[model samples]
Target chain A: MMSGSGDPAGLDATTLNCHELGLSFGGHKVLNGFSVTFAGAGITAVVGPNGAGKTTLFNVITGFIQPDSGECFLGDKQLTGRRPHSIARLGIGRTFQDVRFIARLSVIDNLLLASNAVSGPTGIGLRAFLSEKRIREEHSDRCAEVLETIGLTQKAGDTASTLSFGQQKLLSIGCCLMNPRKYYLLDEPFAGVHPELVVTITETLKKMSKSSEVIFIEHDFEIIEKIAERVVAIHQGHLIVDGPPDQVFDTDSVLEAFVG
Target chain B: MEYVLHILMLIVIYSVLAYSLDFIVGHGGLVSLAQAGFFGIGAYAAALLSLKFGLSLPTVFLASICLTALMSLFVSVPSFYLQDDYFVVVTFCFQMIVFSIFNNWLEVTRGALGIPGIPLPVLFGWEISSKSEFIVLGLLILAFSALCIWGLTRGAFGRILHGLREDEVYTESLGWNVRAVKIIAFAVSAVLAGLAGSLYGFYVAYIDPTYFTVMESILILSIVIVGGAGSFAGPVIGASVLVLMPEALRFIGFTPSLAGNMRELVYGLLLVLILLFRPQGIAGKYDFTQSKGAR
Candidate 1:
């Protein structure tokens, strides 16, 4: 566990810190020496072009893909090589770029499944069933609340596959509400969504950022401009710019890299 | 009539097998090819206990379930790290290994000759010798299995498995241990298959290495696929169709060998047609697109 370093740039008590992370697939280097410090409560947008390793960053941070080297910390806990579920249990939630959902299950069931992890016991067995009857009621209530917040209450009973692309993305976010983490890694949340839903998502992220830290990867500079307090720019697996949104946007080298 | 009772018994037993596979292949999206191995382990365990040790049927059946559960740990541990074709290959190897044991362990299993004279199920000191009594026993077992399946799919455990089947990465991100859930699902599936095997051994009163071959595993897989994989009624429908098809073929007036070959051809044709035209099967709302990799 690494915590409470007095340096101003150090990670906060409820933040995620990655140091010297590296990864390679087959013979290609996807990430190398990637390091960033996310604070406790703000939106840190990972703005980059396609193939910039943004999703890779999320995968590494969430423990889906182990880095060749370097360590990650959530709060005081060292989460270098932990399993994804363990990282999630430590209060880190994530959404995929492709918007993965249990398509056969209803929207409500998807949220209910997520809620079970937070509301139910940790282990699998008779204990999970015997805990109490009230837990079920609590789970249903929480699922309803999240669905309403995402404006998906009307489609709660519908299968997730039947929802519009924008609604599906919102449902994906709502699924994470069952166990709201202190850190969120949202991978291209607005990739294919409509402009109206974009505003709704931005507002939702703003509200989420008030209580938790958000590390999102977005291609849309407009959305980045509206939501990002800080932006880290990557080009071809290398970090080129990192600072305030306007400052990074103003850099001549970043503009050149984007154009070239 | 006795033959009809025997077929009904097999339907009940195979229904359990098909439903159990539904969990791994249907819900977890792991297409295991080792179910017959677990099934054989149950049958042989019961057969060995009854013939050699003269144990009662109920005691032997319970012991058979425990044995298969322990065997499941061996496959489940390795399966946690493998997926898709590799997982299928490993399970295929396991099925071969179980079959080999059945054929080579002469002292215990009597090799291919198998163990015979297994006592019929006796409940409350009444031997179920008559066909009606056996049918009653089979129906009761089917009812209990149906209850178990219903309880599992409706509960929190089933929800987690469904999530894993749909999108394992998303499930993992939601704080669910994907591997552990998969292992549990596999184990439960094995336990049910083992129960079916135990019942099968007692009902047939004969056990042999030939009964637990890879072809048998394929037959079980076909039943799951043709009936609909994830739905509760899928296995029952699939098992009934598969079990009754061969019997219905008796009226074709072909030689025994030709009839057997035709039955196999029909099974193959049905499987291919289902895969091509209706991958969802009869009752399934979800297609095979939610397979393990899709997750």
Candidate 2:
């Protein structure tokens, strides 16, 4: 098994840990008993070739898919069998690789969809209706703050579909930033982005990692080195290398599999 | 004057139904064919309560809402396990089942014989029997329903529904209990639809299963589609156009036999034209064909 020996339980109690995770479709195994513990905070990039199960790993972690057999833990909480919304309520924010957002809605409304307290039945009744304006204003204020952080403050009132691809990507990330959480799973934030916007996003991720765990998937090594303090390299559903960017990127097989 | 008031009253009732349908279809993106079933349930429920129990209009209204809300679960539960066409199929089946009950359950609904002499609604000791008086009552109810829908669509809740429509997976990832939100939206829609049906029963002073058939459901769906899905004014505008268009046809040179067919022909033509010219609807932003991969 091409697995790393990093013991997340031994290191930090708040770290996200997965134990012997295995998942398969028919006879094809996508995640072959993969195991790794993410850093408690800071940006960690999961770099691997296409079809290496990076997205599947994200799916399992975010409760979109249940592993065949294994346990996932975030701190003391068991997240393996929880629903996606339950996982989200536990402070795990997620962004899609496609930058999925309500395009017909304005940028502010899109961000407000992920705003806090809109979860559960509390946001559905007469009481919710009474305070809806206040809540909207509050969320809009926070969205404005997030848009400023992501350099989308000028386009707050603009519809999401009208935004450029890079701006949409930034908006997707800004949505995750609406309510501060302990962990953020950003799937391929740098994909199809320009180099300048990539720098902007990298800086945003760096700032985000200051107080929360920002685990991202990226194919670009340069951006990975700049943004990712820790790197976990996966090949064929197994973690081939896991360490600092300097150590992990220097691995012979990882370098060959990626660049070569 | 009386005829115009009657048409305006009908507009109010249909506007309520259109708004309710829009909540589920336009905002939640669930093309439910079961709305007519809930509407039928409300109508039958109100009619029976009014006839058998001799309850007040307000009591019958409450009962209808509660009953139809519970019935909405029949479709909402299927939504969790099904997607797109399958979800619509399930709703279609539920709609048929409800219509069958209304048609075949002669013991309660009176079947083809139909229920007659449903008394005018008495609100706070005032009988709303006259056309003008009923119009006032319908307007009040319309205003209330409009207010509730406005409240729902203007806040974080509305945004979440839009999110569900846009991408259920993404909305789920954002900590929204997608199933619960959709179920609640369906229930709220059913409640309003039920209220409209109850009002229809009291206003018409009679009702038959024919009034709440799958065809009626299609008409309500058309109102949502023709008006606009997400826009607040879409349903009201759609209801006004559809209800008044047929009446306006009477003023035109067409004979009675040709006019009825002409109204339908015009309706179909208008919908086709709207599809060609403005696929998102007059006030809507969502294009039906463009819903896929739009995230």
Candidate 3:
């Protein structure tokens, strides 16, 4: 494995910035005038209490939910109100908090599906049919590499539903790894994970953060402290703290929000 | 010899219908009940064009595919928003609408009295009026269709279809246009069914509203489920067994009246047994319900 400090300079260094993002669900405000800028490299943790709009933030950023009034940008590229797949094609890889996957597909097949650049809607014409074997082999090689990185090489042929919950979570992250996106949005990658697998996943993410920007929403402070160099915390639909891990965790308002 | 050729020809036509249904039901996880509507559209279009307009076989075939694909949009558009049960209901309604049009539109469809004396195509100045000669043409089309379906399902498009079947939302997040996938798959299936319909019209030299019904759609669905919905051999195997079983019953000393009812009974019994013993189908990879009890 390569070192995690290789200047983090493979993808485009386009920072994901949100400006005055506001949203409400039937009069209950989820995110009110939320704004933050995420670095194009390194691990940035988004932490928040329940109903603090952390999930909503990721949804809006990923184009799953259109904010009431605000805009998101990757450098100068406008992202607001775009479809999820459009945003994904625009270089954003995201994993769901619930660890959703194509359960019927094989473990390696899931990874193969992730690489949209290489695996999207190939033609069924004469030439395409002739080159299918080569295409499949190339994708299989990439999937094998991803399976090895995720420590799931043994289960490559198994259906995804047969994998345990934590393994499914790793497989989900492995799917994201197959794509070379500018930003990675992982929602609660650590939640409900076994400690040993957590260590494996954490190391995998750390390695990935070196080449691409990794933005993850997490609850475990220990995990956030271990991987997150910068922390952006939200409280009740607002950005209450944004700084280094030590400073953000030590803030009185963050402590109050957690306790009171 | 002619009787056997006739049975085999019907098997080939139904195989096309079964596999077409598999594309939507098995790959896309959509249970469309309007397949017979598309099938009816193809047969009527082919029959009318060949008889009234004197169009060649190629023209009628292309027209049939185009017409059925256009009609398939009625089902595919709703699938974008409706959930499972509701989607089935919508297809059922569409099937009824098409059936009513076939039965009532006396000007074009001739209502219950389907178009007769539908002529077979003459190729290379040779009239393919014999059953054996028609079987050759049928097998060639079947082989071409099977090859195309194989090429399609083995590629990236097929993988995306599998993803749509499992989890559509996750597929969208992977940079796939889920709506477009569903619509394309539905159209492909409709076109295939339409091709089969045109072939059936030409083969029998007749067309009728009674041949295309919701029950026909369910029969094709059973072929997919019994033979293995997602598996390549499933539709072919299912279609062969289903088409031959009724013919076999007649040879076993049962009268034609009893044999007809017996065939339906056997189909129901076989389906129940398959669901109980092998819910994943004969060669299927997916468990449709995915329940613990099924495993």
Once fitted onto the true fold, the runs of candidate 2 whose alpha carbons sit more than 4 angstroms away are A1-13, A117-132, B253-258, B292-295
Q: Give one digit per residue, the lDDT tens place, for model 2 in B215-280.
A: 788888888878887788988999998899888899987888999889778878988888888887
Clashing pairs in 3: none
For each candidate, what is the lDDT? 0.80, 0.83, 0.83
For TM-score, the strongest prediction is 2
Model 1 lDDT, full chain set: 0.80
Error of 1 at A222 (Å): 2.1
Instruction: Residues B1-295, candidate 1: write the lDDT tens digits.
Output: 8787788887888888998788788766778889998989888887878777878877887798778878888788887787678988999999999999999999999998988888777777989888778777767777877777777776677778778777777777888877778767778889888888887888789999999999999999888898898888998999999999887887778788898999999999988898899998877645774454342
Candidate 3 ranges with C-alpha deviation above 4 Å: A1-13, A117-131, B251-258, B291-295
RMSD of each predicted structure? 3.0, 2.7, 4.5
Best-performing candidate as measured by DockQ: 2
Q: Answer with 1 or 2, whichever has the higher lDDT.
A: 2
Q: Model 3, chain B: what is the TM-score? A: 0.96
